[model samples]
Target: MFTWNFQYISKARLSSTLKQLNLSAEQGDILIRIHTAIHLADEAVDLARFVKELVPKAVIFGTSCMAVINKGNYALNRCIISVSTFSEATVCSEVIPIMDEYTGTVLPVDMLCGQIKKEFVRDNTKLILTFFSGQYKDAGHFVDRCNDFFPSVPMTGGIASCAQNNQDDFSDDGFVFNEKGWSDRAILVAALSGDKLENLSSFATGARVIGDESEITDTFRNCILSINGKNAS
Candidate 1:
């Protein structure tokens, strides 16, 4: 079995974030999620590169979001770094641009899943932490395909949002990146694998309705495909 440790740090404390992380052991990852009214795409690239320089070997990836929350405080333009160090587990990263840079075409769902299939390991893959482009509304389709191919390993992640300020202006500036490159229309994926790697993601909202369990028979990306043989509204 492998163990992992995480620490969430704000931009104000970023200088020490890496030092505090146990990277000396040399097997870990650094994930950043930035949500800023003034966060520029170029700045994100710089931040990713800067961290990569320091760690040199850790898998680094992240996404630009509309808002970022940490420990109880919320900030629109703050940089929050989520660092994960693992022992007895391994991680790999992939950044796939859904939009064809040459032809300016959007990749279809099946094709996108095909790209993942090339590297996906059914049994060894323990978890999928991805930051998907918010522009693509077909995330549910991707999830469905993943479930079909690798049902046992849980997939978890968030959709990127480029919206900024009170006007909620969503632009094409949203991006996801890995150590190799960054893309405004890509999916940043970090796959973790281990025989006993467990998923510990959870949340609680006192007594609030969590909704009833329902079987989803179909889906079209982010839209509901079907439920109990009935068309989803």
Candidate 2:
């Protein structure tokens, strides 16, 4: 496995780094995480073309982030690309569009869960990495359904968020890209299986709890109807 960090969005620099890796595209898959500030958002199609030319058979998956976590530190406006070559392990990915009707109502939780299970449930699956559009109103419920489906398998991912600067202004909506192209309202899931790869998952939240614990008593879709003895609202 090899990971490279680029502070600036430069196709020349990216190509140079890939050349240095001395890897063949047929060997493994590539995962890329980019900050939304980078102009790569404007030239994503061209970038995908360039990567495909380099590794025609390699599966490419990428997503935009508010900030990239690198080397135990958060980096702003940076791009992190990880290339992995697994001789004995297997890797595969699938993209599912968010189910939204013309009226903008999303599919029910049970239906969404069924969609995920139909696409990703497989034998020997060890790790699942997911990336979803931050615009989805029910992203939390979607994640909970995923967790319930794959309780034994480790899963990690986040909602794509726009870039922010010191002024706190956000720009450039986030997206996810794959061999089929990119979309702003889709979920990308990658599964890795085999004995050659070891996986560990962890998460951290910036919010701190200040009040007493409350039990969620009622819910409707993604909204909580009541908590403890009072209405959630």
Runs with alpha carbons beyond 4 Å of true place in candidate 1: 1-13, 25-38, 166-173, 202-233
State, as a TM-score between 0 and 1, how close model 1 is to the true structure: 0.75
Q: What tens digits encode model 2's per-residue C-alpha lDDT throughout 163-211?
A: 6652144324577776466777778788777766777787778999879
Instruction: Tell me how far the alpha carbon of residue 230 in candidate 1 is from the true structure, in angstroms, after superposition.
Output: 10
What is the alpha-carbon lDDT of model 2 when measured against the actual structure? 0.68
C-alpha lDDT of all candidate models, in order: 0.67, 0.68
Any residue pairs clashing in model 2, and if so which?
A: none
| RMSD in angstroms between candidate 1 and the native structure over all alpha carbons | 4.7
Q: Give the Å error, residue 116, model 1.
A: 1.2
Model 1 / residue 55 / CA error / Å: 0.8
